[model samples]
Target: MYENSTELAENKLLLLHIIKSVTIPISNTQLTDIVLENSFVNYFTLQQYITELINTDFLKYVEVNKKKSLQLTQKGENVLMLFKDRISPSKLNQIDEYIHTKIESLKKEFSITADYLPANKDSFIVNLKAIENDTLLLDLKVNVVSKKQAVDLCTKWKHNSADIYNKILNALINE
Candidate 1:
């Protein structure tokens, strides 16, 4: 177990590191194995760390065939991103609320209209329509230059007004 003052921060980092490094869901035994092999941390201490991570909503536990697995939640992902960005708590909370509002507003304003049109001789065009108060309509179109380039682009959209951009990107990729 860690000292009370640093336990939360330490466990949060450990969980984020584990999740970011592993592509597959990790079992407790696997976590212990990695910790023992790579770090000076002990099994019991690591277990305590994992428990704290779960309690703090950073990690989620799943049971498969009587084996337990851990994965990061969206909140956990946000935590990791905040750590990467070195964002202050006040700035992080502000960004979080901003993103939330944008998403909700975009979802309410837009609808997919058409998809998978030939952008060129060998490309695709995705179309979307914005509905204002369920009455007025505005159309937008996005061109995908290649099959490989048609992957979801909305996942990368971020800004104060990124919601509309993400909505259009999502409609394109899904279409």
Candidate 2:
């Protein structure tokens, strides 16, 4: 029973450590994926730990880019730094490795974005973006006559934003 409690404590600390190491606000879903993907804890237990952290003011919800994200509170940082030795060095190394492997994909996922919204009875607005480090590389809104067109545009924009941006830039500069 003591061992189990210790494991739970470690898991909670592991979570706080990850949030700190991420260096940016992350969504709850993203945090869940990171913890679960690393096999650090089960979803239900993670949820419980997160709730406790929030209640204790160790973590809080914040708005970033108009989307909800999780951030570690100042108290959480103090607590983690104080108790971080509870986690082993090898385990810390493992966490570093796993995050390094996943961080690039996570960065790319956020850097390229596309979505569609209704603009009228028969038309849709496709909002596409290529953002890097909070700087908007491209911000485009296209009005299409049908939902299908909007979706297709959004999909293409997501997959080919870089190439599209390059071509458009070249066309404007070279024309």
Candidate 3:
């Protein structure tokens, strides 16, 4: 029983280390994903741990661009710093490798943005963009008569950007 409790404590310390290692605040989904992917904790258990951390003031929640994310509190950082040795070097390396491989894709997923603006009482303009490495690769704006159309276009652009971009380049090059 003592051994099991010790392992649980170690897992919580490991989680704190993972949360502290990231430079930017990460969404709860992202955090849970990394833990789940590494087989460190089950989903329900992770949720419980997250609740416990928040209750203990080790982790605080914030909203960035209307999305919720988790940031390590000062107490959380201090706790991790003091207990970091509870995590094995091999496990730390695994966490590092998983994050390095996934961070770029996560950034790209957020880079494609879409929005709509009221052009007039009867018309709206939908603007969509795709950015790579901080460079704007595509910016398309279309005027539509209805807000629904504008919103639909924006949703379609986000989902079909690669295909649409390829088609546009192909048509232009052949012309």
> What is candidate 1's CA lDDT for residue 155?
22
Best by lDDT: 2
| Candidate 2 Cα RMSD after full superposition onto the native fold (Å) | 2.0
Alpha-carbon local distance difference test for all models: 0.56, 0.85, 0.81
lDDT order of candidates, top first? 2, 3, 1
Quality of model 2 by C-alpha lDDT? 0.85
Residue pairs with colliding backbones in model 2 are: none
* Residue 6 of model 2, lDDT score: 79
Q: Candidate order by TM-score, highest to lowest?
A: 2, 3, 1
lDDT for each residue of candidate 3 in 1-175, tens digit (9 for 90 to 100) = 2358768777878778887775656788888888998998789888888888899988889975455878889999888888888888899999988878888666645667789999999999898788776578888888999999998988888788889888987998897
lDDT of 2 by residue, 66-98 (tens): 668889999999999999999878778888888
- 1 against 3, candidate with superior TM-score: 3
Best by TM-score: 2
Model 3, poorest ten-residue lDDT window? 104-113
TM-score of 1: 0.42
Assess every candidate by TM-score: 0.42, 0.89, 0.69
